[model samples]
Target: MENPITRPRSVERLVAGQATSDGAGVKLTRVLTQDLQRRLDPFLMLDAFRNENPEDYIGGFPNHPHRGFETVTYMIAGRMRHRDSAGNEGLLGPGGAQWMTAGSGLIHSELPEQEEGLMEGFQLWLNLPAKAKMCAPGYRDIPPPAIPEYVDGAGVRVRVIAGDSGGVAGAVRRPDTEPLFLDLHLPAGAGFGQALPAGHNAFLYVYRGSVIVRGAPVADRHMAILGNDGDGVVLQADGDSRVLLVAGRPLQEPIVQYGPFVMNTAEQIHQAVRDYQAGKFAAAAVQAF
Candidate 1:
């Protein structure tokens, strides 16, 4: 599909993270959202935090409430324990993921489980469909091994987390927006391009190294939002660069966000909270195909 946006240019967005305690008994970093207003459809927020010092991490996040959305927590280093009101419990290590669909409502929290005090991870909020907004809650905790990762040796390493990338399909169940994630690392001076379907929005986040997009240079810790209209995306690495490509079809829904909750209307958001508080949340039923 031809992209409506021109060849991707490197535009930098603001960056922000949160300070929280986890398993290791120390404080760590995490993200909330870079700029206000939803830039990506279906996706409402992105948080990235990293800490190496013991006291800087380890305490972990305590119990919190969520409704009308899906919370996806991904870990790249260290360990985290997950416990929720739905009776889901697990530990996530490097490459681990916990995808929880908090339909009507659910309360949960995550904390670090080790004493090293070093933890790094991310949590993303995805909007649920209106019809599914009242569906019962469900959980999916997948280890790093379940996610497909391979080296494209011509200097590309890819980890397919949700959709097909380089013939590798992410093991996670497809969501409403059909999200695609790729952990791409390229050699210095290498140029990479991919064919992206029309109507999909893509962004490149530089975890490390540097890249020159459309004659513009972007460094580490900066996120590049690509134009949605174009044939594909071209990223040229000026140095050994490691980046995350998060792409999904735009969600054309009205978003009314309040703190940790995202919904289509203020009344709907208010009703969601009331349902949870009144112990009236919808229960997840095991449906057979």
Candidate 2:
């Protein structure tokens, strides 16, 4: 059996996300904002949206530009059609994901493929290192079957999205940020553990139900930032719960962001803006079907 977290980290604080709308006014909760970028280095933002009403998400996201970071869109329900200037097009359905690296720049749109029912998912912005901020843009469409998942003896199911868990590797991996993204579903009264580097910044966002970490209750739609003093974390489900566990090694470098552009300095941000305005962002192509 894989070794469990011996010293589980405690919750540093609980954060109530701010309700916001983006991309043609699609309603969402911005869980991680610009203010927390330093504390949660390598991760810029996290937006969660769950809407049953068609009016809330029908507009979807129109053509937008991004540079110097990566966008990971994971869909729990509903379907979204992705098209980009890189000549890439794909349909993201339930249990699928779209990973786009706007390394240098790109123009993309994510429109709804369905007219009704439930629309739920998250969009996470992971910052790139200084060295890779201006690299070639890329994209990947990861279907549900491509993602590595495992069910533990305690009836806890874990979907490893971007890190190693329970001896199962995720579909994508990065060396610089070394991000760990896991979607965990735990049964009532069950527990789960995952080892993490003591130096990495980590947090847990509970979505379905409540969970307890280090004796602190994390309610639905709330985020619990974990302390970095321990080797890992232990979570106990207060009920049948679904949570997102995310961690990454801090870049420790300067972060300067302007809208969808994230760079190391203000000058770089300015350059990105000028480049996008000059139509330089659409030059590169990413074959992401």
Candidate 3:
């Protein structure tokens, strides 16, 4: 029998992350910024925040406002409490995730639940097209148990957060974006391959050990932007490796972003600022996803 998997997507380029601070005063590694390299359509930013020192993340994220995009926060360790102006509150512990869509606008805060230990997580920003930018503001708070996991015979485990993997689909329900966010752990010498939407843009971020992505080596804290020509990605573990794979459809529309706002034009950005200043985020008004 012959294998049907598509040719593995190769790495087009490697992006080195930088140290940065965000969310009140949280220290983090800015892995993929919107301005770096060519624009990664539909994805605005990717930040990895991991620290053993409480001082590094103790400040947490104070109340803040966002509009025109979605923020996905996945916690691998520690606990975070999220509260929004709509009176909705939730606690995200290890293996938990939160997908908050700030359509027109919203105000929220994420604070640490404990004093110390190993605090680690990733916050991803996904862009919305012009039609859905101001539709409604809503959120999906997913516990660890809600996320789907797939394990292969070779000891490779995949946590599917927003897309299908190994025939198992994630519980995250974002109709407009329909993105794929996965965390993969492969044992030493194990290999993994999965098909992806051909039209979607994809990238891989390695945060542990080393892995061979489409025949190219990717070490810790490095990001590999995959070529768009392939329909799937193949990776092999040089050692015990952990990585995050993210992909989403490109809107192919003009994107103008400022601070927490993302829009199609400069005028829309100014309007968003004025809307925030007028205290429009006081109400939850988050629309159903």
Candidate 4:
């Protein structure tokens, strides 16, 4: 069958991810940083980490506080143990995912569960709307089998992580953002397309091999921000490639962030800091995973 996208969006620009370390010296590439948060509304950050050496990711992320946002961690090949103040605990293994909403506040830890071999994954931060910012915190651990997948005739496989794709519903979905998170695996010379709302902000990050968008090459470890002129996107793989396609409706609200806390105003950010320091972040118990 022909690709669904008729007017594929062009590449606005190519972005080379910045190398950084987080979560106790775990080296990673920050694909979506603070500067691009506004350009990609309803989404804040995207960090990709792949390490074969245990020393690189051994330290893991200790207990840290977060508020006014949501975190989605997708594991490509690794085991991570997540524990939060709300008594939620889960083991995220290969091809699994964990979604946590730090609505109000919570302290959590993500530690590696493996001693050696390859560890690869991506973590995305999705902002909560002003109304739902203070709602109760929530958590969900989705195993590999639970995530919906779609395979086309051309051997293009897509894992629908957070939205509908090819008539398949993802494991999790949110209300305000209506975010679409898809992981695509394309064979050499294969092509895949997805229809995206024209108003949504979208981007694609190539993690393996390379792909072409509107004749623009997006190499491995590089990101291609899609222009808003088109309704969807069509990607052609130069070789066996794997890429992440993320899009979400803009919140179009003020974004004030301080470290791990995100709010709409400076005062709200300050309040989050004060609340975390005052031991009020975990005052209420949340539902278990």
Candidate 5:
């Protein structure tokens, strides 16, 4: 049994979320640094968009380019239409996901086609290593049931998307992404302790309600960063709170980010655009949708 971690002595940065839109009218919530320059090393950003009115999110993300990173989309409440320049197209309904590794390069678009006039989901960005920066692009569209779910004796529910924690291997893959993904739910006024891997950079994003992390008290949409010293994290609920805990080892690499591309060097960004403009991997577009 993991012992309860005391109050975090080191303070965590309470980053504020921002609001933006892509694909014309698709609303989004940015959970990390407002400027891409300040984005975390291994993780770039997390965007959450939940809309019930079709007019709010139906426009979706238009044709765009990405390289040297992976785009993960998880739909919770509604449906989304996915078409990529790589010629992979599908309808990701509720509890479905589209994990795309835009290794070398890829062009894609996401359109929301909610059946009940609602569109809700998230898109997370993960950095890649220099060696795999130019690898071929690929994708995995996993449905709701494909993800692992675990229920604790204390009425805590967790959906594992990646990595292992709480006896759940969310999504199994060879040398899985270092990060652990969990959709956590805690009953009102309940408290729980999460044993974390030492030295792993981690954070919690509140989606539906407020939570008291280390007694700081965070509300929905706010991201709470955790220190690397502790082995487990403590979370206490103010109400029936729902949150997403994403933890991973820091890449500690130089990040050069542009609008849709994340590379290591500025020159790499320049070359990435040049390669795309020159049709270096133009055929990648054919398979994305």
Candidate 6:
């Protein structure tokens, strides 16, 4: 029997994401940093946006370019219209997800599909290794029905987006960074636990209600960095808690970032900008919807 007291994993650090805006005046919270606090390698940034006021998010993300990395957009509520220069288009509704690998380069935009109501979602940036950074760009869109869900007798629910839980797997497959992305909902007085990949960098973001991670308390809107020694994660709901758990293997490579471009060297960063201006990025704009 597994000892409930020995959770192996515990909160090592906690950070309250800073307030920031990106992509044509869209408001959101920035969870990861590009500076010293960048303990979550391979995983670059996490932007969480939730607003009841339509004016706060109607602007949405305008046309933008990205390269040498991948972006995962998971929608919890509301609808977003995505259009890429590659001629790909889709309406991402509630509980949908889009994983875009901007290998080489790509231009895309995510605009609000509606004019009013609440909009809540998360956009996570995953770094590509030096070798795979310039690979062919591709994308995968997973609708709400396509994503698998699991529920225990205790009323604890889990939605797997990019990993496996209790033998049920997520929709995202073979990403450059082997990622485990899970949405967990624990009802009042409920507890949840799961085994994590060994040696993976993991963290928990509590977005609703309060919870206990390992032996520490985590409130809403806060991120908890877990120690690497843990082989699994444990949580207990203080109320009706909701959280997102993400883990990935660190690349441990040089990361040179400039705007939407992420590369290993400064020279590569400048070349990306020059290539975009020279229309070289248009190669990714294939006429495929």
Candidate 5 Cα outliers beyond 4 Å, as residue runs: 1-11, 34-39, 172-177, 285-289
Q: Rate the local accuracy (lDDT) of all candidates.
A: 0.69, 0.92, 0.86, 0.92, 0.76, 0.84
Q: Could you tell me every candidate's TM-score relative to the true structure?
A: 0.85, 0.98, 0.96, 0.98, 0.90, 0.94
- lDDT over C-alpha atoms for residue 173 of model 1: 50
TM-score of structure candidate 4: 0.98
Task: Give the clashing pairs for model 4.
Answer: none
Total colliding residue pairs, candidate 3: 2
Model 3 bad stretches (over 4 Å) = 1-4
3 or 4, greater by lDDT: 4
Instruction: List model 1 lDDT by residue over 1-289, tens digit each.
Output: 1112355534534343455544335453443353433676667766665677756665577766777778788787888888877677899898788788887677777877777755676777777877777677778888878878867646677777777766667866555678777777788887666656677766767777988766767677676776665656777788899877777776777777776667789998888777667765434331211
Tens-place lDDT digits, model 2, residues 2-27: 33787999999899899999999899
lDDT of 4 by residue, 1-289 (tens): 2358878999998988899999899999999999999999989999999999999999999999999999999999989999988888999999999999999999999999999989999999999999989889999999999999989888999999998888889888899999999999999999888899979999999999999998999999999999998989999999999999999999999999999999999999999999998999767467533
Stretch of 10 with least lDDT, candidate 1: 280-289
Query: For residues 23-64, could you state the per-residue lDDT of candidate 5 as single tens digits?
Result: 777778787653633334477888888887777786778888
lDDT of 2: 0.92
What is candidate 1's CA lDDT for residue 235? 75
lDDT of 6 by residue, 1-289 (tens): 1113354599998888889888877889998767622578878988899988887898889988999998999998999999887878888999999988898999999999888888998999998999988887887788988889888767888898987876788887555468889898889878887787777889989999988987799999998988887778888899998899998888889989998999999999999999899887766833211
**Steric clash pairs (candidate 6):** none
